[model samples]
Target: MAEAAELSDQPLFSCRNCQNPLALRSNLLSKNFWGKTGPAYLFSHAMNIIVGQKEDRQLITGLYTIADIYCCNCGEVLGWKYLRSYDVRHKNREGKFIIERAKISKEY
Candidate 1:
């Protein structure tokens, strides 16, 4: 396992356009889709069907399969992918999230 100190020391992902450090936004995690019941009901209902109804339903929030890092200078996408975290719940927690690996595209 990696150490917390090692993770924190890593640099934050930045945007390619502006060269600014990308902000971690939850909405950028995945593609938004409308559900049958309604736009708001789609995600929650989909989760239920996939994971099944259970006590930990509240805890088991849908997955964030992507991360958006932008540039500080020009506002460009630096990278994108499913972030690897030590704790799923406390992903943004200090000493938890780390850029262990990343894929930088030409756009970035």
Candidate 2:
């Protein structure tokens, strides 16, 4: 259908500064997340991003080893990726990406 075709043509998220494609809407997992700037979204997969060094940090949920993610095109700090989680309850987030809502724009 027309809607399906349109959806396939556009990215779900993009770098606000450079408009580089970041993640597809299909990869979106959850919107109930927090980032350094403010609200964030969790994605099962992300593209056109650079994962920084892994560092352990104590977050509201628990201690997690995360890497700051940057937009490869513009080098903007978008959010962080969970490289490791100390708590079993948060293990599901180990490989997920948390993109800050303020750093990315919805393409649709």
Candidate 3:
């Protein structure tokens, strides 16, 4: 795993709207059993959420709680999962709780 310091001096990828740095927060499921026998070690970024569109986009009002995994500088919108309401419920399935959304200032 790469350390945050390693990416500190490096240019950051940011959101087009807020211009905040994108942070990498691995999902628990993906953190488990990623490497088997076939493929070496596949660290999937699918778990990450995106915020802005490109470079001049903003964070939509309705679209909140985005799962981000990118840098802050240079406006690089990374992986994100937009949610409508705080109450995300699904029948017969375990509900996911998104604690809160934070603006990333550095890389990791």
Specify the highest-lDDT model's number.
2
Model 3 alpha-carbon drift over 4 Å, by segment: 1-50, 53-70, 85-108
Q: Which lDDT tens digits does candidate 1 get at residues 4-54?
A: 354345443333333233323321222232222222101110100111111
Candidate 2 residue lDDT tens string, 1-108:
885576568668889899988899999999999998799999999999999999999998999999999999999999999999999999999899999999888887
**Higher-ranked by TM-score: 1 or 2:** 2
Give candidate 2 misplaced runs (Cα > 4 Å). Answer: 1-8
Clashing pairs in 2: none
lDDT at position 13, candidate 3: 33
Best by TM-score: 2
Which is better, 1 or 2, measured by lDDT?
2
Q: Model 1: which ten-residue window has the lowest total lDDT? A: 41-50
RMSD of 2: 3.7
Error of 3 at 62 (Å): 17
Write candidate 3's Cα lDDT for 1-108 as tens digits. 365565465554334445453333442223222111221111222223434442211232222343433444443433343333333442211222221223222234
TM-score per prediction, in order, is 0.21, 0.90, 0.22
| lDDT at residue 42 of model 3 (Cα atoms) | 15
